[model samples]
Target chain A: MRRAFSRRRKPWFAIAVTVAFFGMLYLPIVVVALFSLNSQKSLTVFKGFSLRWYRAFFADHDLIGSLGFSLRISAVAMIGSIVLGVALALGIVRSRGKLGSAAGLVLLIPLITPEIVTGVASAMLFKGVGLPLSSGTVMLAEVTFSISYVTVILRSRVAALNPEVEEAAMDLGCSRFQAVRLVTLPALLPAILASAILIFAMVFDDFVLAYFTTGVTPQPLPVRIYSAIRFGVQPTINAVGTLMLIGSIALIGLALLVPRLFGRRESLSQLL
Target chain B: MSETSAVRLDGITKSFGSSVAVDDVTLDIRPGEFFAMLGPSGCGKTTSLRMIAGFADPDSGSVLLGGEDVTYLPPNKRNVNTVFQSYAVFEHLSVADNVAFGLKRRGVPRDERRERVGRMLDLVQLTGMANRRPRTLSGGQRQRVALARALVNRPKVLLLDEPLAALDLKLRRQMQVELKQIQREVGVTFVFVTHDQDEALTMSDRLAVMNGGRVAQVGTPEDVYERPADAFVAGFIGTSNVMTGTYADGRLTLPGGVSLPVPSRLGLAAGSRVGAAVRPEKIWLSDFEDGMVQIRGTLRETVYSGATTTYLVEIAPGVQLSVLEQNIDRSRREERWTGGEIIDLAWKPEHCLLLCETA
Candidate 1:
């Protein structure tokens, strides 16, 4: 009787826990979205629905330029992270014994250290080197932190791969580069693509690093949003937040969907 | 493609840290011959195969392919392919694409790659499944696809590292037969690695038994089985009842004063310690007669297998010997040598193999 009662109640308990977890994550986002559509400019009380804030935000050239600047930096940073990450991952995986373990620990240090520390140290290093503080410097700083995450993720994927596959390709008359391009790279593509997307999202939302690295001319979207929030909350800000949330959701959705579509191809190859 | 040795390993030695994985070992794999390196785990059979394939470099040896020194060449330059134990099928491509991967890397024309991949798929009996994913297939199907992927390149030598170890008993038996047929059809030098004695004996034309990071013996299955070079080979290759003894005047005297005739060509001096190896099937149970040395003992246990019956006979206070007999109907019931029954065990003179005692 006890087992039967517990089994019957288990699914309800699981449902309650799942709902609570997701509710905690999405409820605030939903409230912000609702307030963005409210007629009143203040968030404390809601009036009739209005698209006035949306129209005003779309007309704001400064917000548009900031968003564009953020996109460009994230794009560059993602590519930089992938290139540096793949090389670091391969090097760490290829090293042998104690040296390999030591290299792995060194790579993981950047990932575990505080992002503020990384930002401050990188900013100071650029200043010391006499390089101008620009969007490029911002990209460089964010990439320094983002690449470690990419490398740590990709290294595990590369290490889990069977070494025999690459060897078999080489044994079949492929050069080392050819084998890697044909076999190893294909096996690692899913993880590499996923890591790139993750790095891009991280760079896009980053504020502290951009704050320490940005120049006087062009600022990233997060820095712009931070300045706007400090002045006093406005409905235009909520309007901008809603749009950014939608963009993030769309980007994340693509990240999830693209893998599913490409993953189907992988399953087909295994069939052969 | 020439009628010469396809691969050769001269004095190959590979070490990992302080442990020598592959000691100085040399072997020549003839073209189109199916050879097997047979040993238990960590005996360096896989390491030696990997060295020949160029996946691993020997510490002090040369690897040759068709008379060309390929010791320093990477695996990509070698004329060999491997079917891994895991099958290692590309998870993100169609069956045809996976098979065409090596060809595409070699810059084969798209049309020619498709044609070759199709032919190879048919050869491995996986033609209709070209568009399906590997995960959707059974283990046997995935294995065939891996074979097609490797064979499509038409490499000079194909290496198989325990390719059938993952299958169930029935499937493994089926694959063993299929693998032998495939090797014959492809006419490639097949270098197979396995730890199962039955697998090596059944599939290989010539087999090398490895032990302690060294080649204990290399010969045809019958040669190695009938005349093992050492105690390790004798004990590893088949079921053998071993007894410590001394060889004198072409005879082996066991610890219990029982004497058995051995071949005179062993060339062992009198009183020299040796090991006498006799297969269980060679021993017979009967009453003792003149000119025949026998060990009188009571039967301790009997095991009735489908084809043969094994008996555990206690020859003395502590020594026990195993004997196998064919399961004839009359012998199965009438000659039921139950526990505690006194029996005399005997064997022919030539059946005993005198081996050097191992430290």
Candidate 2:
């Protein structure tokens, strides 16, 4: 009788823990989505569903321009991060002795240091150099921080790889560069792609560094949303937020699916 | 194609801090002969192989390939290939692409590259799995892919760093035979590194035994096994029943006051101490006989291993000796020797080898 009671309660205990964990994470997002569909322009009370706020957000040219600017900046930053990150990871991993350890610590500085410190210091440096603070500066800041993350991820992946593959390639009549390009790069492609997706998402969602570095004329989406929230609790803001949340979710899902589909050949190669 | 040394190492030495990994040593590998460097771990066999591959530069000494000084040449410039222990297959490419990588980089025409890759895949018996990934293949299949990738370039020499170390017992045994056949078929000078005595003995035309960063012995497997130069080589090559004794007048005096006739080739001076090594199968066991050099010992254990029955006999205080006998039939006479029974152990003069005792 005791064993039957315990077994019946075990699944309930598992379900309770899972539901509690997800509720703590996504309950706020669900509330925001509900408010976005409410007819009344108030967050505290629920109202009947309406599409007026969604239509208003779509028609707003300024908001759309800000979103476009954010996308463009993130795209550039992600590209820059991936290139610099991969190079740095390779250099550090190949270095020997004390030099390698020193290189590793240098790459880790941006990853471990406070983000605000990096942001303010970079802003000051750019100002001192007499460079105009613009969306480009924001992209530069985001790239600086995101590249460190990319290096850390890619370095671990590269370190885990067997050096014998590169030796085998060179023995096969490939030059050093060709060996790296043909063997090393392909082995690291999945990790590089994964880092790029992560960096893109990070740069897209970043606000503190962008706020300090962005110019006056062209605020990024985060900055626009911040200012709009400070002014008033408009239903259109909720509509914009809901659309962005949905779009980001879809993009992350696509980023995850692409590697599985295209990387099948790569997985096969690894088997060989 | 020219008449030159295939691969040569002159006074090569490598050190990490104060500890020397590869002591100053020189060797030459002939064209199309399988040479094996056999040693235990930390004996610098792998280090020597790495220096030849240009992955690690020697602290001193020069490396030559085809009589050209390639000591400072990068690995890419050398006409040599290696089949690594891990097989090192690129995880992101198909087996065909991995095998074709070298040919592709040489700017071979695409059609020619495809033909060569297909031939190599066939050579390694991985033709049907060209499009399959390495992870999907068995350990032996991956090893063959690695072999195909290295062999496709038709290098002057091939270096294998314990290539069969990862396989299970059955696969490793099968691969041992296959590797020997493949090396002969390719007709390329092969330099293999391994610690397994059976592997070195079965696969190599000549085996170089290394110990403590030094070449202990280099000879044919039979020469090394039958006539080991030192105590380490004697103990390492195969199982041996060893006893230390003093030599005088073509006779060896054991600890128990038993003097046995020595082999004629061991020209040791009288009163000089030496270690005698005799194979287990060579030792004869029988009931005690008068007027014969013999040692009395008790049979401690008997193990019947289908082909042979091995008896563990205690020859002296704290000293155990192993005796092996061919199992011709399950006769009562053979089964009569049980544990705790006294037995006499003896061997012929020619069966024992005199080895140098290391200081």
lDDT, candidate 2, B1-359, per-residue tens: 45566788888999988889889778877888899999899899999999888888999999999889999888888888899999988877889998888777778899998999999888888879989988899999999999898888888899999999999999999999988898889899999999999999989998888988888888989889888888888888888878777788777777767666766344567788877788888777764345444667899999888788888887755557798988866432455876899987887666687776732
Candidate 1 lDDT score relative to the true structure: 0.83
Candidate RMSDs in Å, in order, are 4.2, 4.1
Give candidate 1's error at residue A123 in angstroms: 2.9
lDDT on C-alpha atoms for all candidate structures: 0.83, 0.83
lDDT by residue for model 1 (B14-127), tens: 999899999999888788899999999999999988887777888998988988999988877777788988888877678888888788878899999989998998988897
Taking the candidates one at a time, how many backbone clashes does each contain? 11, 8
Q: Which 10-residue window in model 1 chain B sums to the lowest lDDT? A: B329-338
How much does candidate 1 score in TM-score? 0.90
Query: Cα lDDT for residue B113, model 1?
Result: 92
